[model samples]
Target: MGASQPGGPSLPQERRLVTAIPGPKSVELMERRNKAVARGVSTTLPVFVTRSGGGVVEDVDGNSLIDFGSGIAVTSVGNSAEAVVRRATEQLQRFTHTCFMVTPYDSYVAVAEQLNELTPGDHEKRTALFNSGAEAVENAVKIARAYTKRTAVVVFDHGYHGRTNLTMALTAKNMPYKESFGPFAPEVYRVPVAYPFRWLTGAENCADEAAAAAIDAVTKQIGAHNVAAVVIEPILGEGGFIEPAKGFLPKIVEFCRENGIVFVADEIQTGFCRTGEWFACDDEGIVPDLITTAKGIAGGLPLAAVTGRAEIMDAAHAGGLGGTYGGNPVACAAALGAIETMRAHDLNGAAQRIGEVMKGRLNTIAEKNPAIGEVRGRGAMIAIELVKPGTKEPAADYAGAIAKACHAEGLLVLTAGTYGNVLRFLPPLVMPEHLLVEGLDILEKAIAQVTA
Candidate 1:
């Protein structure tokens, strides 16, 4: 038996494989998916999930795989959490979609109130609801531009905001995300980020130097006056779980504050106790002018929010800041339920425990494996950057081999980093400690077998 949280009954939290990774049933689903689904949409493990919760995803073939990726950090409170299921089910019976913009709803206001209270800082804040992380991010940019009436937005290297047109421009990657999707929004600038692992001078000098470079680029190249916002992921998400050097974030935040540029923290993947804190920015006590949230906000429902200084969030005209289905009553209910689960389970502390376990185990693995470059991140969001045996060069293929091996063993994991050489883990905060330990064991064994 695995640990259980009062947040509700979760899956057994065990890894059970009735057949191969992509068993016959999953293969049938895969065949169907290939025919109907767009080719642009790709599957990672290629198994159709029948059900999921706590720490495992039950595939169509009866294979219950340990879930290390919480549907890209969306199921942090755990799938079908009691409050979530109960509230969402209740809302479903009552009404599903009465757009907030048209009629408004109490649950939507309730969610905004929670976010205002939970997010970093005690300042008066306002929140606008949206449907996805991308939508929320784009809206954040718009709000910044509207409030400041500026044209340029500055981002950092290895930052990932979203897939929308403006967000694609905000994103630093090229191939998969922004390859052919050109004519992207203008005035988006990319700057250097303090990446301690990859910094040329060394980790000791990373914070000061990177911050200087970033600040220099902003002032000299983009001119802070023209910059509407400076968007950054406190810990790089898709670009690898690269936590900026201890002092880097504060410097940037200070710079934006001094220069009148809005500091927008893209907390979509790092918020909601996923990072041990309510928001990653809270770790450094660096409060952003605007914060974007999604993924784990509403249990498994699609919901996103942008909470910020009231003046900035309210700058947009009333009719300008909403969508047809933004903050659907059902989704708002789910968000409230998800928040209840977070509080009930003390998921923040659970994330801290996950970080302790994952980092300790991965660091131990790194001590023995020369190919494992660096083990870094906070809370439940962690990653190991793969590199050549003796150098900092990314070992992309090595990462792929390791991930493939884990998948073969019924352990689902995801890879990230601009070089595609990082194995990122975003386990549910309610995941059983046994599952966490076992997942690390599988990862360690995979590394050994690959090197063998």
Candidate 2:
């Protein structure tokens, strides 16, 4: 049996290290996993987890590690949240799955209702649940096409949609996600995002001008009348949490409105209060025609959703919008609990507090280290870009070494962005301030040591 954590039944605050990171047991299990699992799959951190709670993950080897990655931002309310576990367990005991499309259930409808009410905009909205972020994104494209009767969809550079065929086409990065998986779906086009940190045009360019250039490029390449939708993450996720300039999203929305093209926000990674707001798009007061969500929605359960204006969503035929396991009852139950936890704990507020702490520390480090290029993100979704001193050239190898050092010292961080030189932080909103500070100290020391 795995070790039982302390601090009552619900929340555990301890990080107990019973053995080395991949001790004898974990190394053995990893070898087995390699044989059984596909080689295409990869892991970002070592220390295989068997159980997690609040802010810590307990590995099979019985070492408790502070989790900064939050299962890649899925466990926003924290792992094994009391409400989420209770609701999921109860639903499991009662009924596991009824296949919502075959025989609808109240839980599925309830989840849909929550999406409608919670997603940005006061406009009348409709929602459909699916099994993953990729599925939700694909379905949104279908809905947009049905509504506009158009063939073209536009996505921005550095934006990550998902892994499915259509979504892989939507994703901006070429390798890993879209590699070896193409012949991708056609009618999908890419536009450049105004990444102030790396844009050759310079950050001094106004948001409006940058946006106009992108819009003009799209209109010139593919007539707006032929475009069904333009999808984006308000703050790009895997592509380095790049937040577009102030006017970019509003400009895109205005262009979409004039052309009758749908605007979809892929909030899978930034949703559920990860960005200090319910939706990252909320920051700009932009209401997307359709919003796709997954990551933190079901509190670690496999559930995703597409929420949008009712009229646009209804364009799809009844049978065109569902999956066998869409809105699984247990997952819906977990979602209900997750939402409740967010409200009760004020995870949005927590995210803002964490962001202040993170940005403050990272910026302080940047002041001292010439190798640090940029620090950016909102709320809990933060990243630090590494570069060679006095140059914009990326230092991916240096970043990799720093990450390896952190792992050796029991801290886990993830690398992202096209250049692979940015270290992104996705700590659970429920993490303790003390633990967060400790991790920051370790991160700062590692960078100092490496740069020296």
Candidate 3:
């Protein structure tokens, strides 16, 4: 979708429900899915979306539900974004699949150039494209390991990387994501994250303590020389959008530098202006050795990348990094259009506007609902932690109930965190003001209902 011409009809902004949520058509599809699909796979929401655009998902049931999850923050530009669709369709018309490793395309090179220019860090950089966030993270690890000639990788508690074997080792949560899928990749260690609201120590000491504890773990267990990289999300994504303390990131970077440990910023969820900035790591002014991104890249097409210092990236010998679908021509085309759309419409500014509106509404809810313990996050990626009154213990039951209520009210929301007590809102940056406010109102009512 390119920019609108002089006077085309503006996109519709309201949710129009012509039938009950999960109406006849959706129910029929679910029945078919259960019979044909494997039961092992998991789903966050039940409604089957037939068409999506702007800020809403039109379910097969004919109910238009406001989308706050953005397909888990994938469709940043918007579902069926005109620019992305146009570019992708045009590219597809030319050719479907050529396999970059076999035959390269200019679009792939263009995408890599954009990542090198846009990603944080002013140093000379190079990028490698991949299939998913986990693939990118895995590739980053390969590069780090090859560069540093080390095997150990460290991750923080409550952090989520992905579901692959190595990433499963990096992820901290046990249930759902990693449950019953054990025997994960080895040489991975976990340390406590600076979770201020729930942490025992004051915010003043948490950052230093967390950093120290991690360094200690690396030194005592694996030794600094044996470690390849320390991976972290500047603003934890599924880990409740928890913002680390002021000095936390810098200390980590300093420690990494001293130990020659590659600091990998897992920007899969926090990249693409989702957190008010181009990358959340930029806010701290820390230059991670490597940055991993996906989800929003290519405007929902499967594309992920690892951008890092050229030397480190070059450590991988010939044919060391790449995938069959990595940098698919159509996906690259979509990414180019997505980047243009973000700049043309100033979606970053819109994300800040979204954050302000969401914060105001969630703070008001926290004031009235004792179950809400914290309202946190930056930009469009925001979350509210639920807890019992006068205690810091997570209230996952209340969070689940609230989510169910929101879905029933035609507002799609998602829950995350190790305890599953944090409700995260990841609405598209193109979301209309009124629709966003309406979703917030629904969220308030849902929380109130659950609390009552």
Candidate 4:
């Protein structure tokens, strides 16, 4: 039997390495996948997953690996959570889809109600459901443009929105996300973010100088009157999980407010107790005009939402929004169950505790390893930047080596960052303390071996 985790029930929680990491079964599947799957669709860890619950993912190879990635922060309440499974199963037994737009469902309305009540602001709010983060973000921009009657959309460096054409223009990274996929949608402006670790001057002056520089550029170049929205990730997700300098977001929020531009918080990775709060915007009390959410919202189900002020949401014409499979009944049910699980288990507290534990361990690791340039991020979404010793040059090679080492040892870790030099950890909040410590121990060993 598996030990229980914080958020919900679990599978056999121990890390059981049977054969090797990619055992015979996984290797066979990989060979099959190589033939069937498209080359464009890549995988970080190729072990075919059979079951995942709480803090562990059981592979077809009969190995149970510690899940620190959480399906790229999609399983915040833990994979195959009890509530999610139960609710989704019940919904599946009934009606699978009639489509919310085609025929409304109570679960859709209920999920929207929960979102309206839970998202940052107290003002009257409305929520529109979509199938993915990209759709939600795309719709948020559309709503903003509709409300403001403007064309330009301002985005920041190191921000990751989604994979859609508009969001590809909004995202900052190249190579994987935007390389050769351009001739993207126009009227999207990119600006600087207060990335203290890579700031030109110094970390202390980063917030003020970077914010001022961003505002100045937006004003002079983009012309605030023509910009409909300023989209930013509260804590960057795919771009290394960089948390902007403390006062940075608030300054941008203020600027957006002054210019009548809808401030959109792309909290797809930072929301749903992942950042020790319901939303990252709550940390600094920075409310946005529109907030896009996904990833953790439905405990691994494909459900996304755009939640914002009622007036702003209503600005779109009657038939301007929605999709055929948007807010599928089963996904909506899973979302409600996920929300219930989060509240019932105090996942926010669980996330805060994870942050405390991870920071304490990560700080000690950074102290011993000069390759670790910086340790930053909040709650379950922690990351460490790798750099060359005695220099700021990104150690992307070291990052890759350590991650490979961890994979060989049965620890599931993910690499990120624009420079490809960041090791990001998004442990399930429900992960038991022992597993967390074990994962860290494996990481420490990998770091020592690789850096040495």
Residues 1-452 of candidate 2 have per-residue lDDT tens digits of: 01121111253555556666667888888888889989889977646777887677777777777678988899988887788988999999999988987887788888889899999999999999999999999999999999999999999989899889899999988878988888999999998887888877778774766698779978899989999999999999889888898888899999999989999999999999999999999998999999999989988999999999999999999799898888999999999989988888788998999999999999999999989999999999999889999999999887898888787677878888888888899988888877788789889998988877
Looking at candidate 1, the ten consecutive residues that score lowest on lDDT are 1-10
What is candidate 1's lDDT per residue for 368-409, written digit by digit as tens?
999999999999999999998999999999899999999999
TM-score of each: 0.98, 0.96, 0.97, 0.98
Return the clash pairs for model 3, or none: 1-82, 1-83
lDDT for 278 in candidate 1 is 90
CA shift of 34, model 1, Å: 0.7
Q: What are the runs in model 1 whose C-alpha is more than 4 Å off?
A: 6-10
- lDDT tens digits, residues 398-452, model 3? 8899999898888999999889999999998888778898999888888878888
Q: Identify the superior model by lDDT, candidate 2 or candidate 4.
A: 4
RMSD (CA, angstroms), candidate 3: 2.1
Q: Cα deviation of 422 in candidate 1 (Å)?
A: 0.2
Clashing pairs for predicted structure model 1, backbone only: none
Which pairs clash in model 4? none
Clashes of each: 0, 0, 2, 0
Off by over 4 Å in 3: 1-11
